[model samples]
Target: MLFFILTTIGKFLTKDEERDRELMARIKARDSSALSELYDNYNRLLFGLILSVLKKREEAEDILQEVFTKIWENAEKFDLEKGTVYTWIVTLARNKSIDRLRSKVYKEQKKQSTSLNDDDVFHPLYSNESDPLENTILSERAERVHKALNEISEKQRKVL
Candidate 1:
């Protein structure tokens, strides 16, 4: 009994890569201190990886938190045979940063693909008009729409 207790206690007190894997196993058992320890150990390296990929301090900071949260959530799925804890964490940070970068790029591409006249969609149709003239033009446009709607068949109206 004494030897078994000593071995059990010794397993919980370790350092380096072996310690990290043990922490992950403890985290999978919902031990908060192990999660905190893992974060304390790897946060800097992961943050640097994220920053290099994103090239923005704020975005990198956010991604680092996201990566850790992902690790915490997925702790139960961690496989020691696959890789070291650092490799798993680094991969998470890199993948998340790359995903965020891709999203920002996609949004920028969408903006670029938009027509240059896109602003006109929201600009006053009669920016130069007096109040009365603007109202009149709006009324005319509304009337035209009403007329066009009336001219359409019920099926066409429903489709529109």
Candidate 2:
């Protein structure tokens, strides 16, 4: 009974994957309706992911729109061998959200630095104060590097 249930679940998942592939093929052919259908299927989930990253409804909405726009423009680049359609779209949404977030942080930093006068430079070239955004970015980069290092052989990882 357990084997039967697992097999049935697998069949349903395969059908969903086939449907996603069909939609992607239509999108690659420049079928706007297919794009709309894809958006309808994924928008809520993607929007929730974007909003979680951005923590702002308006910015999340903007990023979600951009994610779809990218999907529309780059449909031909999709490769099932690399990953499933769901993974591709989710990655696009997450990346767009992160890009927007990084830009916002950079803009805020630029604005703050520009507002400082010559007298502000006298404090020190470096300070004990930490910028939370900078720390977050550095930590993320470090985590990614650590993951990548772990993926390689020990010799290669040690050399890097």
Candidate 3:
């Protein structure tokens, strides 16, 4: 009886497809319960991933909260056809942590009047003002990118 019950519970918890769909629908409907369920299920995983990237508990916690807010606001963007909920959540947490890390690095660089390593592209102390020549070059590159994507096969495009 115990083994049977445990197996049943495991199967229920493992139905990620149904769970994600239900949770996403509820979140879209502004259901706090579903949001709480999502947070409870993935909070520790996201926190750990963020901590590994940010290397600070406080920052990780803050970014974890931000990630949850983002997920709540953007729950409709979750598409099973594209990826799993875990992948979406993990990517969200990872990106937020990396953004935080970059912000911190930029600030430190600004205070010390130094570049972030050999790449000074992120130096907040400097400004890249709008230039018509630069804008025209970027527009041409973007058009080329769109043309290249359209020319590629589905499999090749997916790999890209």
Ranking by lDDT: 2, 3, 1
lDDT of each: 0.68, 0.73, 0.70
* Model 3 lDDT per residue over 63-147, tens place: 9999989988998888765544655676687678778878888787899997567355344322366533234335545777778
For candidate 2, what's the RMSD? 11.4
In angstroms, the error of model 3 at 44 is 0.8
Residue 146 in candidate 3, Cα distance off native in Å: 24
Give the 10-residue window scoring lowest on summed lDDT in candidate 3.
1-10
Residue-by-residue lDDT tens digits, candidate 1, 22-83: 89989999998998998887787677667766789999999998988898899988887555
| TM per prediction | 0.61, 0.63, 0.64
| Candidate 3 to truth, TM | 0.64
Compare candidates 1 and 2 on TM-score and give the better one. 2
Candidate 2: stretches off by over 4 Å:
1-15, 114-160
Prediction-by-prediction clash tally: 0, 0, 0
* Model 1 poorest 10 in a row by lDDT: 2-11
Model 3 scores what on Cα lDDT? 0.70
Candidate 3 Cα RMSD (Å): 13.3
TM-score of 2: 0.63
